[model samples]
Target: MPTHLWQKSSYSAEANACLYVSTPDDATIRLRESDQPDTILTTTPTTLHALIRSAKAGQLDHLSTA
Candidate 1:
C-alpha cells in the first residue's frame, strides 16, 4: 500500500548494469535491474540472505551453464 523507494548498490555506481532493491514493508523485498525496470523479483529477507550466502560460497556456480 505504500510507495517503495529503490536504492542502487554503491558498488554498482561505476558499472553499466546496476542492481536496485526496495523494501515496501518489513516482510517483503523487491529487486530490479537497471536494464529491466518493469520486471521485478520479490522475496523475503531470509531467502535473500540465504541466496547471497550461497552465491558467495560458490555453491551456485555449478548451476550456471555459462
Candidate 2:
C-alpha cells in the first residue's frame, strides 16, 4: 500500500495518546495509533461515518478505559 498523509487527531499531544488517520485514493480511511505506525486498521467511509456518529452520541464511552 502506498503511504498516505497521516494526520494526528486534534486532541492529540506530545504525550502520545493519539490516533492517526489517512484517507487513501480508494476512499477507505486508515487508522493507527501514533505510537505504532506499523499497525493499521482500514475502514470504509460508510463505517467510518457510523462510528463517528456513535462516538458523538456517547455510545462508545464504555469502550474507553480512560
Alpha-carbon RMSD, each predicted model? 1.8, 2.0
Question: How much does candidate 1 score in TM-score?
Answer: 0.85
Candidate 2 local lDDT, 1-66, one digit each (tens) = 776899988878878758898988677889999778889999999999999899999999999988
Taking the tens digit of each residue's C-alpha lDDT, what string does model 1 give over 6-57? 9998778766679999998899999989988888899999999999999999
**CA error at residue 62 for candidate 2, angstroms:** 3.6
lDDT of each: 0.90, 0.88
Candidate 1 minimal-lDDT segment of 10 residues: 8-17
How many backbone collisions does model 1 have? 0
Top-lDDT candidate index: 1
List ranges where model 2 is wrong by over 4 Å: 64-66
Per-residue lDDT for 58 in model 1? Answer: 100
